[model samples]
Target: MIVRGKDITGPLRESADVCIIGSGCGGGASAKILAEAGKKVILLEEGGYFTSRDFDGTEGFAYQTMYQRRAGQSTEDLSVTVLQGRCVGGSTTVNWMTSLRTPEFTLDDWRHRFGIEGLSAKDLDPYFERVERYLNVKAEPDENHNPNNRIILDGARALGYSTKANGRNARGCVRSGACGLGCPFDAKLSVALTYVPDAVKSGATVYADCRAEKIEGSGKTKRVAGYVLDNERRTTKTDFVIEAPVVIVSASAIHSPVLLLKSGVCNSSRQLGKNLTFHLTTAVAGRFERIIYPSGGIPQSAMCDEFLNKNGDNGGFWVEAVPVYPALAALAFPGFGRAHRERMREFPHTGASITLVKEIDSVGRVTVNDHGRASISYDPGPKDIEYLKQGVAAAARIHFAAGAKEVMTLHARPTIIRSEGEIERKIRAASWERNSLALFSAHPLGTCRMGNDPQNSVVDPHCQTHDVPGLFVIDGSVTPTSLGVNPQITLLGIAEKSAEWLAENFAAVAR
Candidate 1:
């Protein structure tokens, strides 16, 4: 049964065979698998549950209700905007639905470098196939590409760069271009619509608006203590606790480490809250003479991977188009009052494409502050910054190839390019300092990394924390290295693998 904490009359307590502390791709997958295996499962989510009817397709409503910290969460230095979901469906509800598998190179790195066993491409193929078939992951038709998405397709083709249509998870999508604001038509089959409900049907109890505060383990039983949140007021309404033999922490990379740090468990390696990576992202907007209407159709449908892993360095970046909403565009477009207003007036005629840089040398950390909230910090390596500059230049060139009249970068001072010749000089002159360029990361990973050595890693190849018996972490937090693509499918596959192991060894684990 699914229950909303706000609707509960008083403090509620329950015990189960397994307790999952999150409800995203990892937690949702685990809940369904474990429950179907005949183990009583309980899932806890800090965000409220909302369906298609509640998604109003407005930025104001979506941000205030579904996003983490009202879509304002950032690093300790306030340089990179960290976008994460804080709802029953987690990021699956808010993501653009561009589902991709973990790059084969990444999997190889995990196996050889990190000594992660039994997780090679051949081993994970069956799991990925299952998830793809269930979620309807497929590439959209060429006709479905809006002008914004076509920018990447047509421009890349003109420049002789290979481009491909992105495979999305939506079945009967209407191309509303509001995937980031939560799919209002239910066409996008997020975990909230697919796995969460299926888990409930399999007899798993899910509590929304209930945050897990700490996890305590004693001999054979584990206790999870938390408070029921008053969704509207953002205050604690009641306290609740659940005792079980197995506890799984599937919170995102940022929150998972913080929860473990706060609980004082799973830190024997001193690696619980380290090795953070964000697919560092920025955009280059181009002005077209014709109306592009970037906010109408599919938000992101095509991508150019020509630059990714270039020269076999395992670095570089990939390019995709971004959906331009009023509020987001205002913050992203360069310049002050009058200049910003002028740009907003031209929003209808502008097309923007963003680049996601896969971190090779950059490292970030996630820790807890005095108030027990997540405090994130990151410093990009010099090589990564150079990749960003190259990405910006390449995107600008693509825009020019697509016949854009003018192009602009999201730098604080702004680099404006009128002709193709200006792209290089202007981008090179722009500042690459922390606050100098507007940066964003929707994909945060690698905190609580997996490996063979207990002294160097927090979890083993099976995802069980080395320091805590019967405690496992099955989320993006467990990725030993950065994935060069969208990680939703990869996370689901990992959860499937781990949950299967847990179910097979339930009796031994429970003892």
Candidate 2:
């Protein structure tokens, strides 16, 4: 049964065979697998549970209720806007529905460099297939592509670049283009509508509005202690404790390490909160002669992947269309006062594409502040910056080829391109430093990374912590490197593989 924290009063205590500390893709998948295995399970989520009825298709409401820190999360320096979901379903509920499998090259890199065994592309194929089937993953036909999406497709093709429709996890999508805000039509098959409900149906007890404070105990027994939060007032309504033999942390790349740090466990290697990576992202907007209605159809139906893993460097960027919503567009557009207003007037005629850089040299870390909140620090290397410049220029060229009247980068001092010949000159002149460009990261990964060596990783190949007997982490936090594509499908596959192993070996884990 699913319980709302507001419905409970005073301190409560519970026990289960397993306790998972998140309800996102990883936690939801784990809950379903373990519950179906007939293991008594309890799942805790820090955010409130809201169904399709609650999704109003408005940015104001969605950001306040569904997003982390009201969609204002960022690095300690406030340079990159970090978009993460905080509600029961997590980011899956708010993602653009672009689902892609982990590239074989990435899995190979993990095997050769990180010593992550038993997770090759071939080994993970069944899990990916299982998840894909369950989620109805498919590449939508061309009829579903919005003009913004067509900009990438037509432009890339005109430039002789490879582009394709993105695989999406959806059913009965109405093309409302509100996937980022939360799908009010109940068309997007997010975890809230699928895995979470299935887990509950399988007899797992889920608690919403419950924030895990810290974990305690060791050996064959462990206790997850936390407080029930009042979703509106942000005050503690009550405290709770759940004792279990097995514990899994799926609290995401940002919060997983914070929870571990607060509990003071699983850090023997001091690698608990290292190796953070964000698909460092920025967008370029193009102005077409006619209104594209950029916010009316599938938000991100296509992408251009010609530059991914370029030059055999294991790092490069891909381009995809982004939803051009008013509030978000206003914040991203470069200029002040009248200039910004003039740009906003072009909203109906604007189409934007984002460049997602898969980093190779970027370094990031997640630490805890004195107040116990998460503190993030990231430094994009020189190579990553150069790639950003190249990506912006390439995207601009594509816009011009697609018949754009003008194109502009999201830099503080915007680089405006009116002709193909000016793309390089304008983009090259823009400052590439932090605070000079508007950057965002919807995919944050690799805080508690997985590896065979305990000295270098927080989790082993099976996602179990090396120092803890029955503690495991099944989330994006366990990814050893940045995936060049969307991570939801990849995370689901990882959770399926790891949680199934845990279920089959329950006797050994609960000992």
Candidate 3:
């Protein structure tokens, strides 16, 4: 039922009730929900379907096979790192399986600031419950903790900071900190193993390795009409226009905006690619006298939300425990050649966690090139730099409290502090003036934000484009602001709710 490659040729040549793009968490979840409702669906993914056997537990090959723009190719300038998955399951296939719901505060902010109605926690609870049920979301019990996870717990307890087990979509995970490398044991519950399959079983057709070139349509009478697909070997046109009155764009925050621009829809607001927010993260590594293989446990078993509620004026930052693999650690280390190699050899004795700073009102743009590829332009704002410095100082303190022999900050200066007081002083003195730190983003939001007013937002509160009928964007592209947490679960919840709304309203709109 999960047709791929050659199997898509004939089916895509025909029409369906709805066509959804990008079979990631949002798309996959939407497909399953709509298909189960007995609607004909066709899901298109630009990448191939890769299983556990295809994952080699290495960074290079996985990047080539599963990642979009390749592993290291995509970046906004050389300083800001951007990573996105490009497989049939999209980023869900390669992402860490941590699942956290959008915070209530964020929902409230959307209601108050954007005038978005019916987005409160109470209204969304049902959708969250349904998503959690399908994902089998649960916290990591004590037995699941590994050295990497325990260190985080010990640090939090020692510092009088709060910590809680993180909810992840997994079962029988043996604590193998390889979630970033693609879960080899098939324990990680990604969409490839969940909704995508469910959609197939419910008779939805899936097409992989098919890159959608352009969405053909015009004005409020738009219908997507068809798409030009290229699979390297051949290029063809699928003019299968659906009689149904809906088209769902579930592409990620980055690509969805680019698609809209290419299609000449929602361009009036000019907000399709503005307001990009990346939960900017940096790591702190410490050396322990005892051997602690951080990679021997579940990748992310716990997190500290002690600062999650810090007032916006107070420069709030969110810190979470993260396991680092040797290769990734080396990339983050602030040294060259011999020093870096020596540090890499001590990977077994290193413990690290990343701190994500909720940035200020920083704005970025996503632009498509003549070749139809998406490129991002952004730089951290001044307030964001201050927040990063505060977060780095805090992360250093946590490691020192955990009985670290020495702590290393992931900055250009590479300050190594042995005592708690020195950690604070050195981190404070560290300069973020030049944007020298190795910065990366896992969550990208607000590219095509939603609001009640069409003048300020690309999409309406119901996720429909202001200038285009029969078009809806049901992914992170519609996030009005950063949720300051992993967005995969929240995106699924939104997609589920939006799909239901579309299903109920589609016939009325069609008439």
Candidate 4:
């Protein structure tokens, strides 16, 4: 049921009961649920499919084949780097496999503040449990904790910080310490290896390298129009038409709204690409005396959420170890030339952790250019900068507690910290602006938020567009606010619940 779109010649037109325009976590979950419901579903991906053999664990090759714009997608100011996956499995394929449920706080806020209805943490528990079962989610046992992860736990405990164990979607994981580059051993169970295959077995067809360009028609008579790209040269090889009564857009936060705007659908609220929120994150690396091989163990095993919401509900941040790899770690370090080189020399001794703050007041927007490509114009909330300083200071204190000799940050002048007392002083002195500390985010959300009102939201509680009857968006883009933790599990649970609704009411919604 899986086909390389490039292999198909001429105009490849197809019809289906439903069409899903993405193959990541949301789309994959939808495909599995709808297909099992006996709907003739077609799942399309803009990137080519690759197996464990295709992954060599190299940054260059991984970026080239798997990342969005070769992993160079950034803000208009080139300040924040958005690392989104552009493959069949989407970000889940390249993510560190850290899976966590949506916190009750986030879900409750959505219902109370955003007018979003019919779902709560209690309502989503079954869906969360289902996706966890399907993806082989498991907690890292204490006996097998990796050194880098151990550092996070030990450091947080020493400072009396409440640490949370990260549950990952891995079954027979080999502990290769390189999940970001794609799991070569087929151990880290991405959606590609779990949900997609199950979907295929239930009669869903996945066309890799097949991009959904624009949807045609409106209301109940919706259709998806797109083309398949050549996997080798990355060019359009053939045009494809997927006629369906129901068309779903599950592209990521940035691109989902771009697709809607380009297609001229679902813009009644004029909020298609507004309220973009990224968990603004910054990592602080410490130099330890022991050779811990930070790059050789689980990337994220522990997290400290003690400071989350510490600043009075403007949204807070969580601290965790950055899954370490040489190329990525080196590039993320501050400065270039001699200082950078010397830092890499101490790579073996470097144990780093990052603070990811959930953003709610960002004036960020995702706009499309003349070519219809997605571009980011985001400015982090002012309060978020103060929160980042507090989180960075906390990370520094933890490293010092765990016996780190010195710690380095993304600041310009006082980039390194040798004592615990300077953590607060140096952080307060530096300007907490974008690019001040090499900030990175795996979670980008809220480009097309869901709510009960069409004036303020793009989708209804069921994830269907308020303006377009047959058009739906089921992805990170539909989240009303940024979750304070990893988002794959939340999106998956939402997709599953939405798919259930779509299946039961297919006759009523889809003409």
Candidate 5:
């Protein structure tokens, strides 16, 4: 059953067959699968459980209530603004619902470079298919795209670039463009609406507003302690504990490692919070003469992966549509005072997109502060800096091809470009520094990576901690490398596969 703070008063303690932290993609998937196998699962989430009825359709209200730090979280250097969900479904409730499968090239690279076997795209095909079937994942028909989504297609086609309709994990989407705030219509089938509920049906207990403080025991023991956060009261005073034979840390990459380090569960390797990958991203918005309600329909409708993996080793970047609203667009579009104000006024006529670099060269780290808050630091590699410039230039070209009157980049001086020839020249001249442009990171992964070597990785191929036998990290943190696409599908696939394996071997392992 879904248990909230109101259901309990003061401190509490509980025990379970398995304790899963952070009810997002990985935790939600694992909870459902393990519970279905008759395991008593306790799913812990720091965020509250809310439904469509709870969404008010206001960006400000949603951000303050549903997003991490009211969606204003940034890195240690403030170079990258991180947006992560804080509610029951985790990011699944807030993501754009673009369900792209892990690229085969990415999987192959992980297998060979990171020694992560049993993770090939072929090996994950069945899990991906199952998840798609469960979520009703389907490609939005050409005619179904909103004007904003259509711009990506129109621009790509005009430039003779290969583009594909993005697959979304929803049924009968109303195209409300509110996925970032949380799907108000239930058209966007987040994990809360699908897997989490299925988990509840299997008699799993979900504790919302219960933030996990840490996994208490060291080495092989599984004991978790945390407190309940009452949003209405703005207090996290109540204490709670969960003891299980198996403890799964499915918190996102940034928080998972921090949680581990604080709890002192397994740090023998000290590889807990290293190698963070963000799919480092920046945006470019184009102004068109024709009115384009970019925020009215589905966001992220199309993807141009023509530039991706061209090097044959699965590295490059892609330009994809960013479902832009006035508040977000204003923030993402670089400018200030009158310049920014005038641009938002043309919100109706602007088509916006972001260039996502599959960053690898500039590795980042996640460390906790004195207050145990996460602090992220990333420095871009020299080559990746060039890649970002090229990607933005390409996006500008696509917009120009699609009849954009003008285009704006996140650069400092030569921010706005009117002609195609200026795209590269201006961007090339721009300084390659952190936060040079308005940078955003929705996907934070590879913090607690998986590999065969104990020296370099936290988890094994089975997703269990190398130093702590009963501890497992079934989230994006375990991914060995950066995924060039949206990471929801990839994370769910891994969790599903890991849960199935645990179900089959639980009895033997428990003995």
Candidate 6:
């Protein structure tokens, strides 16, 4: 059953076959799979359950209510960007709903570079199929097109850049473009609407607004006994200790590592919070002769994968059109005052797209503060900066090709370029420094990586902590490396496979 509100402070009974933490795409999917397999499951979420009616389409209140640490404003060295969702559905509720399985090349790299033997594209294909089936994943059909998607289609067609409708996990969407602010329509198939509800129907219990502080367990065997949680009232212990013999950490990439460290499990490797990767994104905008309402339909409808295959020093970015509201657009545009206000009035004529760089080498670390809050330390490497420059240049050219009267590039000093030549020079000469430019990332991966070795990786191939026998991590934290795309589907696929593996192996491990 799904329990909501702040009344989580009362006595709680928590004995279950599996206790999963953080009910997002991973945790929710795991709960569904395990409960359906007849395992007594209890899912704990730190944020309360919120429905589409609760979404007010405003940034401030939504961030405070739905996001972690209040929209993850915490910074690392005052430069790196960190964003994660805290509610029952996690980032899936706040994300753009674009879903893609891990690319074949990424899986190949995991096998070849990371030595993860069984994690081939073919091995994961069936799991991805299962995930797609559960989420009802499909490309945005032609009838769902809004003005923002039309603008992207027109621009890509004019520039001769190959673009296609992005597959997203949503149903009955009315083309209202309020994704970042939160979808008011019950169209987005977030985990809260899909897996969480299904899990509840299958006899899984969910406790919301209960924050897990630290995991308490014994040594030698290194099995998690149970966790101490702050229920926004007082510290309370579960009525029964979980003799279930299985603990899964499905928290996002940021919190999972911190929780592991706090629990003193998997310290043998000490690789808990390293090798963080985010798909760095930058936006570029243009004003058209006609109004192109940004707030209509899904935020991202099409993507340009033309530059994805460009290897070596030349190819590094994937550009996609992203619909942005006036408030956010104003925040991204350089400069303030009357010019910004005027641009706000011209919101109907404005269009924007983001260049997402698949950065791998640039590393970041997630560290827990004295109070146990998670903080990150990251700086983009030189290679990432180069890719951003190339991506900006390419995006500007596409806009101009679409017959844009002028193109506005988002940089420390915004520049309006009228021609393709100007766009090239501006991007080529632009500063790539972290502080010199603004960058945002919706995808965070590899804070707690999975591998076969205990000395180098935090989790084993099955996502179990090498030292902690019963503890498993099934979130993005177990991703060996960055997947260079929306990781919701990939995470869900992993969760499904991991849940089945855990259910089958729980008896053996319990002994």
Q: Model 4 residue 444 lDDT?
A: 90
Indicate the TM-score of model 6: 0.92
Candidate 6, residues 391-413: lDDT per residue as tens digits? Answer: 88888777777667788776666
lDDT of each: 0.92, 0.92, 0.77, 0.86, 0.87, 0.76
What ranges in model 4 sit over 4 Å off?
A: 311-314, 412-414
lDDT of 5 by residue, 1-511 (tens): 9999777787878888899999999999999999999999999998889899988777887788878888988888888888888889898988899898999988988888888889988899999999999999999888988887777798889889999898899887887788888888999889999999999999999999998887876433478998888876778868998988889999899889999989875667788899998898988889999988788888877889889887874668999999886778777777578877887899999988899999768778898899988888888787677788889998999999888999989764438888998887778777767667888889989999999889888998879888877788999899888899999999999999999999998865444
By lDDT, the better pick of 4 and 6 is 4
Where is model 6 poorest over a 10-residue stretch in terms of lDDT?
Answer: 218-227
TM-score attained by model 2: 0.99
What TM-score quantifies how close candidate 1 is to the native fold?
Answer: 0.99
Model 2: per-residue Cα lDDT over 104-191, one tens digit each? 9999999999988899999999999999899999998988899999999999999999999989999999999999888999999998
The whole-model C-alpha lDDT of candidate 3 against the native structure comes to 0.77
What tens-digit string does per-residue lDDT give for candidate 3 at 87-162? Answer: 8888888887779898888888889989999788998889888888888899988888777667677787788888
Which residue pairs collide in model 1, if any? none
* Residue ranges of candidate 1 with Cα displaced over 4 Å: none
Question: Which model, 1 or 6, shows the larger lDDT?
Answer: 1
Local accuracy of candidate 1 as per-residue lDDT tens digits, 1-511: 8899878778788899999999999999999999999999999999999988998899999889898999999999989999989999899999998889888888998998888889999999999999999999999989999999989999999999889998899988999988999998999989999999999999999999999999987546899999999887999999889999999998899999999999999999999889999999999999999889888899989999999888577788989999999999998888888888998999889999999998899979999999999999999988889999999988988888998999999998867899999988998888999989999999999999999999999999888899887999999999988798888999999999999999999888777
Q: lDDT score of model 5?
A: 0.87
Report clash pairs, candidate 3: 175-297, 175-298
Judge candidate 6 at residue 59 and give its lDDT: 81
